[model samples]
Target: MATSYRVGIVGCGSIAQRHTKAYQSVPGFHLAAATEPNTETSRAFQETFAIPKMYADPIEMLQKESLDVVSICTWHGLHAPQTLMAAEHGARAVLCEKPMAVSLDEADQMIAACQASGTKLAIGHQRRFYPGWTEARRLISEGAVGKPTMVTGYVVDGLLNTGSHVIDGMRYVLGDPQPEWVMGAVERKTNRWERDVPIEDCCLGLTNFAGGAQALLQVDLTAYSSADHFTVQGSEGLLMVAPDSLRLISPDNSNGETLPTLWDTHTQSAAGSVGFESYFHIAYTAQAQGLRAWLDGEAGYRSEGTQTRHSVEIMMALYQSVREGEVMRLPLEEGAYPLSAMVAENKLPLRYPEKYDIRDPQRRTWIHREAYDRMRADGLSHPEIMATLFNK
Candidate 1:
């Protein structure tokens, strides 16, 4: 029998509940403790999970518990810092929530700290375990899609918020190729919600792969509902994949009948009844499987930090591309977040009036200097910088 791994969760939000349930389901894993800033939620989570210990602060929980595995399911900005803390506490494995971190530098720091501390760092890109997506990848590798020349996909939400899922899913299906470049555009006029995690109103981007494949992505924050769908095309076959279903189109049908596009449909469902909740179960199972494999020394976690950092970079490059009105290359220069810098540059639409007026002489100079540096770092031309400064 495998030895049990003691687990602790750093956040008590909705996603953390799923992680708690998943920990319980996985053999040789124990959800022993949790931490949350909110007392009411902390108490409730403790009661619900029967976790023996709970703390209002994550660092305190780490200091008190002898935990082997730590799950950081906090906000986008907190992932890196919390993971670093968990690693410092000697966690053998740290599973951080998606989008990795708000900036590339933070992602690098998390990876470095975990590597130095011998902690296995994984990101919460759980769709890697979806059976339909896995099947689609298999068929494509087996030439079902015959080389996968291009992919067109759409996500029903904002770019960094929900589009992270779409981007990571495509990266997985493409066998995790190195991204070459991205040419993109975004609108921040709408999608008034999600201020906590600022995102684009709508986004359209094309990311090219080093292996000569490309993916075109569209995300509309105003979409009716959340969705994950993609149509992959190749020389000989095609594939349509979503969260719950997979359809394959090939020239040589099993029936051997000649048709323009002969599709074979495959539907997926949970072991029990199927519904919206089923997707969460699937995600949790995948997380558990990854944890178990890494613990057993069987393989590296699929959504490991190094791999997820690429997605974060891609997401940032998309915004950088929009800001510069040109394609942005891979391995974006590290510093402040591109999205935040874009907002500072007044490149995206603002929902409300400026809270603080920069008209004060000192503040105006500082703000203008910051904008100039950001635009320069992005490689904007002098004329363009003048236009930005004078246009407003």
Candidate 2:
């Protein structure tokens, strides 16, 4: 093998910047090239990172760059086609951002393309690399929580945004059990979009895992949004989990047990891991390190596509449940995104009528990015962030 491998980035947004820093932190990965259609954004990204080549055309970059690793950091709808393109271009591995794709069909296409091309496909559920999460998984499996019967995961934004992590995290702690069925509800009173894809205004559902445990999913269902959390209720105890923190509460102790975060567990070893940021910076590095080992012939990568496909299916099935007006079973028969279909059929007409994107600077409803960053650094949850924004 070569001493180092070439890595290309498909987008130059904030997430892509993080991915660039992570690739730089990990050994044996070089930031060889990148493509961004937005000229100003691409220039800013290139200014911050030392990527040698830039392309306005993604296809041009894919054709010209002999990249071994490709990071697909585009919008939700672009994931599958971009992933298939990367695979077709001989990239050995791809770490595409979450929600994977708009529908199970696109997800299937990505999985099949990668499988056929012999490329390692990993979905960006990097929270799987969180130390607290892994610890919770170990404890749950060893019965520390004892006979987990129910798990409740909550997130804001849309189901495909932070909700994907919530679903994947809940399953991860419970040892990635199979979800058998789901009954869901959604409210889309207006035309709402997240990162250029249609999304429900709010949604909630109950999914029965094949492992005798049930999970309640809440996505944008409340005004009080927090860091997406997974609370597991076992026979012996209850556990509350976030990407960076874990809490264990047993029968005798109401105070609960505090668990290690990256800050707690790897202070000495990971001083250098926080290259561009802290907190999640460590998690991203760990994920990249895991990817490195997996690419070097490890048995499994935690967020592989086939595994992530189940989570996507669960979400899709949830939407389908609302679309069909009944509970939905797994292996969803619907190939298109149900939410988008509803929008297309005018099943969800804009009651308020103006379109808005919560992440867009031009959109006033979206929290200001600077304030969002500042509050997050101050340890504010999503609920607090929104409350603060609304109070003003």
Candidate 3:
């Protein structure tokens, strides 16, 4: 019989629920506990999911439960600390939420803790597990697109908050090439919320990768629709993927005849069209499967922690560029700039809903203060953070 891995989840927030559902759908895994700081929320999560245990504190749950793996579903800032704690608790592996940490340093600490503890860590870049993305990566790796030259990613939201997915997804499809440098601009057009939050509403970044492939990313919260758009341009063809469809164009015709080029004569006609055979909203499901495979010692399973760390490094570089008002080189060194500097300099803006005030320390500190402190204490300095987070 295949051994059933015991799993515990920390943070009973919205995403945690999704993780619970995914676990339930997979075999050879058991959802042992769900923990949250708030007793009410924890209890509610337990009741809603029929989980066997619920704890008000994640640390307590980690110490008490005989879990083989723990899911760090806390706020964006708590990912690293909770993951470190999980590693220390003898868990075989940990699955953390995105962005890994607010700062590069924190991300490093989490990775180091896992490494030291002999526990595996996987970051939740669930989109990579999606069928469309999986297919796209397959095609790219098989040279379907032929030496990708450039990629354009548009994620209509803040860079740190939501842009991490776009950035990570880019790395996933591009074969995790080392970044050369980042040049970007950020904008915060509206301030309709509370004062203390430190997030940006829109950003545009240009990056050069080691393979000479250039990437352009645009993120905006003010976009007209709630859809994502991505395009990859290769030497021979172009590929476009969106929320609803995926299209591939290459330069060869079935009859071996040169096809008519549109727009630019230099562009060659491409071939091949593949669509989603079975329409399934399985992003979260695939993530769960990947997590299980990693814990089961399945070869070739990409750990989530690795992806999260890289995403953190890329975003940090972009943020650094925006702050310094110059192109920031890759592999940022330690103590480059404190998270406090980013907040104090007003380089990182907070974009909240109309109901919340950005100025409230408690409210604004979710992504900045709380997350940074946990990361810093874990022994991750800026450069170290970038190295670990971005290291492929």
Candidate 4:
């Protein structure tokens, strides 16, 4: 018989909602409890998902609930401390959202805490389960793109939020190579924050993986806006990957090939992917399932903790490169978040000082969550919803 896992969510944001959706879809996973600071949002989440318990504090939730799996679906600043709390409380496993932590020190702390407590920890880079991505990795490994030389990723939004996925995803598709070094640059002409964490207006990074490929990334580095996609250049052919689609141009094929979106999960699962036909929206389900499998004594969890630290290290190393104004080598010495230090040192100061949070209006907090939810239910797009919220 498959074992049941009691799950608790630490933050009731849209990401948590998605997590709840994923949990409910999979069997033997209970919607046991959740934690959110805002009382109104807490109640809304509980009632909306039929969660059995809700708490005003995360520590309280961890202390009270006999949770087997705790999902850390909070802000970037909160991931490390909350993960530490979950580990201390003896959760069987923890599935933290991406970018793992704000710094290498915090990331290492979370890892050590979980390791000490005998708890399994994994990050929510669930997009690694995307069938297209998995197939791309398989094809690359089999030499479809012979000798992958360069991976160029383009993304918008902040590095920790959206860009982290691109960089990590690039690594995953590129056979998860060891990053030898990185050189990075940042621009912060306007005061900008993403989920209350200081961020750059735009940035670019170049990471050279050990003897394999060089990854070049541009985030929010366009005249007006950038996008989320990556291109792989190799000796034999090229491949382009996006969120919903993948295209390959190889020597064997004159015309480019667009891979199928859906694949046999049973076949893919044997190769460290999802075990079911779950895709995009339910990647959380795949991640949770992988954690469950690991707890059940299975090997080969894709988003395993020690492996994810490399992604965090690469990002932090990029920031450190910018801070030191030189190519920063891997196994970085800096433990603190270089961006914060750089800003504190009055480096990367604002040329236009009107401070703003890129996601301020998008957050569904106690105050303005109603109109946003309503507009969303009415089948409105994000831009449309934002227009209605602003017009109101």
User: Which candidate number maximizes lDDT?
Assistant: 2
Q: Tell me, what's the RMSD of every candidate?
A: 9.5, 4.0, 11.7, 6.0
Candidate 1 error regions (>4 Å): 190-195, 221-227, 253-276, 349-392
Clashing pairs in 4: none
Estimated TM-score per prediction? Answer: 0.82, 0.90, 0.78, 0.86
**Model 2: per-residue lDDT, tens digit, 214-272?**
88888765545544467899999999887677899998767998877654453225427
Best-first order by TM-score: 2, 4, 1, 3
In order, the Cα lDDT scores of the candidates are 0.75, 0.83, 0.67, 0.80
Candidate 1, poorest ten consecutive residues by summed lDDT: 261-270
List model 4 lDDT by residue over 259-290, tens digit each. Answer: 76664464234233434533555555666666
Worst 10 residues of 3 by lDDT: 263-272
Clashes, model 3? 27
> What's the CA error at residue 102 for candidate 1, in Å?
1.0
TM-score of 3: 0.78
Identify the candidate with maximal TM-score.
2
Question: Which candidate, 1 or 2, would have the higher lDDT against the true structure?
Answer: 2
Worst 10 residues of 4 by lDDT: 266-275
lDDT of each residue in 1-392, candidate 3, tens digit only:
24888999988887787778777766778988878888778778888999998888888888889788898877666776788888889888888887678788888888889889988888877766654555566677888778899888765435665677778777777777788888877664333222232455456788888988888887652333222447788887777755335677777632332222121111111111213322222455666777777677776455356556666777777777877778889776633323346657765554322222333445544344454446545755322322243332
What lDDT is obtained when candidate 1 is compared to the true structure?
A: 0.75
The deviation in Å at residue 239 for candidate 1 is 0.2
